[model samples]
Target: MCIQTELQRFQTEFNQTLVQTFSQLPNDIAPKLHQAMEYSVSNGGKRLRPFLLQIMAKVLAIDPKLIQPAAVALECIHSYSLVHDDLPAMDDDDLRRGKPTCHIQFDEAHAILAGDALQTLAFELLINADVQTDIKLSWVKILAQASGYQGMCGGQSLDLEAENKSVGLESLANIHSLKTGALLKAAVSMGCAAQRNLSDEQKQKFERFAELIGLAFQIQDDILDVTATTDALGKPQGSDQKSNKSTYPSLLGLTGAVHKAEQVFQSALEQIEDLPYNTQPLMDFAQFIIKRQH
Candidate 1:
């Protein structure tokens, strides 16, 4: 099958599974707070992390059902980051997925609280999920590390510091590797961790694959910030430039950014080319990151 077709199939199932699980959260926990959590969590994302987890599962010929906790964990962490990132203290974005941001749609305080709750609930899902204790512990540890100091938060701290400074390509890559790539890397590793019996070498192979694609994903996001329109993006475009944020395109130029993304994509694909299966979904996903207008 073609890449888009595979992606579409996964996206459809992932969305359905995520929504169904999200809806199962208790309604008694302050309905408004639930609303905020639901609003942010249910807000549209490409569902990239969980999708990556499923793809990794496919490599093992494992049932995708086994990875629900990991998938939900990915979505929760992703949504929590967005909630905090859009706050006045952060990006101050007004729109997301074609709607007002969490702070705008809900109050700023609720947004903050919701983000906090989501972060905590991510661990809760991992612990309380109906999985083997060994697997749950491993997944929990990976998510905690990825969403904490070594991952998204760490990256954001660097991004905040680089605001007025001229960040070089290496620094930019480092920041993105942590800020964005960490969770993506975690998603892949967590999927492998969930496997009943994956070889250490197989796990490493997937982890390496994750690292490559994860970095490529962020580069594509940076390129889209400059190349895509707000309508297509479903959020304000050019905000990166407006904020004077250092980006690949700004530092390397647009043509150079595209070339850099291509290089990263190829590097990612190279890690797994010796495996005994087609890599069309991964290839398409890499291309989708750069080729997408939004």
Candidate 2:
């Protein structure tokens, strides 16, 4: 199948599976909190992280059913991070996916609880998956490190600290490596973990690919913040500039930032070239990240 067709099919399958999985959440939970959680998860973005996990599983010939739990779990964790990130104490944004942020649609306290619930729910889904003990344990550790203080959260802290300051390129890269790249790396690693046959070296190569793509993804985001319209992006355009946060375009000029993005994009393709499987989808995904409007 063509890359576009494959992505469309994967997105449909992902949405159906995600809705079904969330439907299994017990009805006994508080109605308002439940509604907030459902609203946040169901209201969508690109679902890129989970899509990467599913695609990697497909490439490895792992059972799609086994991949579902991790795919959903990663998305849950991703959504939870966004929810907290948009809270008044964080990014303080009022919009996401062209809709009111969780804290805006619901109250701040409920949004906080919803994010907390989703965070814990991710672990529950992973633990309950029909996988071996050691692999499951490994996945749990990977996720914790990626989404916790060492990864996304830590990156956000660094980002907050860097605000209104002229940060060097290396300092900015370090911040994004943890903030944006950590979970993305975990997505690829989790997919590899599901397959018991991959060697350590193979896993490392895939991770390197993911890391470069993650950086590329962030660079494109910064470019779009300058170049794309709000309607196209679904979020406010130029919010990064509005927030005075350091971005690629802020440090490197527009042309230079685009060049940097292309460089990282090429490096990602090279990283995965030696893998045994056809990598058209992964390459296409890297292209999509660079070209995406939002």
Candidate 3:
């Protein structure tokens, strides 16, 4: 099947599972909070992290069904991060996935609570999944570290701190590696953890692949912030510059940033070349990442 066709199918199935998961929430929960959570999670965006997890699971010869819960859990974490990132206290954005941000559609307090709820719900889903104890433990540990201070939050802190300050390439790279790259790395690692036959070296290769793509992904995002329209990006164009945040394009010239993205993408492809599986899908996805307009 074509990669686009496969992606569409995966997206449809994943969205159904996500809606069903939301529908199962206890009736006693606050109606507004539930709505906000659903609104944020269900809003349309490329399900990149979950899709990467699913693809990695396939590469590892694990059943997609067996890894579905983990995929969903990873997405919840990603979505929660976005929700909080768009809050007034953070990026202070008003749009997400072409719709009002959670805080804008609801209110600041509700958005905060919704983000908090989604964060905890991610762990709950993982713990409740019908997987082995060790697998669950591994997923929890990987996700917690990625979502907490050691990873995304830490990166976000660095990002906020770098605003309006002149930062070099190394400092910028370090900030993104923690903030954006951590959860992406966790996705691939979790998929590897699900497979019992893989060696530690093989797992490391997959992680390296993820790290390279994560860098490429952020670079592309920086590029799009400068070049794409607000409609195309589904958020304010040039928000990074407006916020005075240093970006790949800011440090590296636009042409240099584009070159860097392609360079990183090529490095990512090398990581998967020796893996014993049909890697066409992964390669195609990585290509799409650097080439994506949004």
**RMSD to true structure for each model, in Å:** 1.7, 1.1, 1.0
Candidate 2 — number of clashing residue pairs? 0
lDDT top scorer? 3
Cα deviation at 174, candidate 2, in Å, is 1.2
lDDT of 2 by residue, 1-294 (tens): 766677778888888987788779865668898888888888766888988887787788888888788888888999998999999999898999789999999999999999999999999998998888887887898899999999988998999999988899999899999999999899999988888888999889999999999999999999999999998888889899998988999899999999999999999999989899877778888888787777
Specify the poorest-scoring 10-residue window by lDDT in model 3. Answer: 1-10
lDDT of 3: 0.90
- How does model 1 score by TM-score? 0.94
lDDT of 1 by residue, 3-77 (tens): 567777877887787678667887786898888988897777878788777777776666788888788888899
Write model 3 residue lDDT over 13-48, tens digit each, in one string. Answer: 999999999989964669999998988898886788
Model 2 spans with C-alpha error above 4 angstroms:
none
Each candidate's number of clashing pairs is: 0, 0, 0
Which residue pairs does candidate 3 place in steric collision? none
